[model samples]
Target chain A: MEPSDEALCQRVAKRDVAAFELLVERYQGRAYRLAWSIVRDPEDARDLSQEAFIRLHESAGSFGGRSKFSTWFYRIVVNLCLDHKRKRRWWKPWAGDAADDQGESFLERQPAPVTDPVDELGREQTMKDLWAAVDRLAPRQRAAVVLQVQEELATYEIAEVLKCSEATVRVHLHRAMNALKKTMKNMEKR
Target chain B: MAKHPETDLVPYLRGELPPAERERVARHLDECPDCRQDTDQLRELLGELSRSIAEPPAVNWARYRAELREKLEARRGRRAWWWQPVPLALATSLAGVLLFVAVWGVGRQVPTAGDPVAFEEAAIGRNLGLLEQYQVVERLDLLEEDLDFMSDLDGLAAGRPG
Candidate 1:
């Protein structure tokens, strides 16, 4: 039987490299994907996720069993990604084109739909526009939405990761959904 | 009609509402077409958002693990160097010297017996009681006049010349 994540985390606190390795293996994909969802840059995602793992190694002793290891770890990753976004925001005007080009490449690599071509194309456009709107959301709102839709965390769990109340998480989701709806409507009008 | 649970709609769709609140929202949805439409729209939008985010590009796990190991080793090495005996001793000595200098500097600022400022401060401290009784001192002339009047009364009471 595999040791639970909490058990592994305790061993990590003691510098058990094997246990740390297992934890990394379990969370690498999740951390990277969550980072990618927030920053929308592959290299930054990889670096931020790696940095989060380093932070976990350094601070594992402070875990204190207050929350699940996953939640604790996610807080680390989300904070790093949000910080990266904030630090990069000033230079984004110059970097925007490159990031968009990377996004286009990623979109092109997506598999084609097997369903009705016309409907899929329309839906695809809508999804693209919706994501673009998501990209423009306030950092915390964007983090809240990604944690909700992509990570599939519970509302309370998102609150723990965001270090905010559940009510605040709901407000974030509410505001995010309203913004996306408004964006979709404007796209339709255009 | 109940006020629309506009904020609660998202939580309701996500099944995050408490059972009683969930039931209330459900009944409200049954009675309210606009809210129901909003719920459906939210559900659809959330679904699309979830589906739209693509999987992250594949990473070479071995390379990543190796790089992390390298970085961790470097960090440990740096920490170890700081804790080594010679460097640790040097750091301790430097810290001790700094502490001594700080104490000496503070000690020099203390007012000594030979210091002019200390003499001035002592003079003020001794006169503080006198300064406190300034109002009584201001009435000294009145007290003197009263004493003279009493002396004259004593002379009259003794049947002496005023």
Candidate 2:
């Protein structure tokens, strides 16, 4: 049987590097995608997600097992991404790192010439416009939305990640969905 | 139809509502065209968002894992060395000594609120008060001179008793 997340955390607390590597392998994709959803930039997402794991390794002893490990880890990842969003202008990806390779925002990246099935769906432009609008949303709204829909976290779990009440999480999701609808409709008209 | 049951949509879609509540929403949806349209829209929005965000970027996971290992190793090297309580304790002791010296030095420059300096100032003020009483002796001397002059004047007025 796979070791429980808490058991792995205990191992990590005991300085078991292999256990930590397992934890990283388990959550790295989720962490990276969550970060990417928020920052919408690949390299920043990678860096921020990596930083979360690094912090987890450093602070593993503090995990008291009161909450789910994934929940605890989610908080770190979201907080880091939200912090990065607040400090820098998402508009200018290359403002600080002039050497940044994937310096474009999600909308600005050049899509492949050939179409994937997802692109073949009537949603290529719709998804683009929606994400562009997501980029425009207030940070809290975007975080709330991503946490709810993409991460599939419940309202209270999202609230835990956001450090707010469940009602506030619901409000954010409602607003994000409404805004995304309006944005997509406007894009369809264009 | 006019009053769409929009409030129930999110929880209903997420299957959060209780069975009774779910049944109620179902009944409402059965009769409500506006709510059905709204639910349809909300579901589509959810689908699009889910699909978009689920799409992965072309990241090399193997490289990511390797780089993280390299960093963690370097970090572990630094942390393991610095985390020895002996060094931390030594640094803390050094800092405490420096702080004590600083505080002690400052205390010497400025006396405590009501200690040595205040008592000395009070003593000096008392001595100065004693010095001011010296002028009272001079006033007594002036009175004696005045009495002598009066006595002489009275003798003269007595038409030179000689």
On DockQ, the candidate that comes out on top is 1
Q: Candidate 1 — what's its lDDT?
A: 0.83
lDDT of 1 by residue, B26-60 (tens): 99999999999988989988887878886778889
Clashing pairs in 2: none
Please report the candidate that would top lDDT against the real structure: 1
Cα RMSD for candidate 2?
A: 10.7
- lDDT at A56 for candidate 2? 91
Which portions of model 1 miss their true places by more than 4 Å?
A: A91-117, B83-90, B105-162
- Report the C-alpha lDDT of model 2 over A49-138, residue by residue, as the tens digit: 999999998899998888889888999999998788766754666563221222224223323323233455646755765676676666
Report the Cα lDDT for residue A31, model 1: 93
Q: Model 1: which residue pairs collide?
A: none
DockQ of each: 0.46, 0.28
Interface RMSD of 1: 1.3
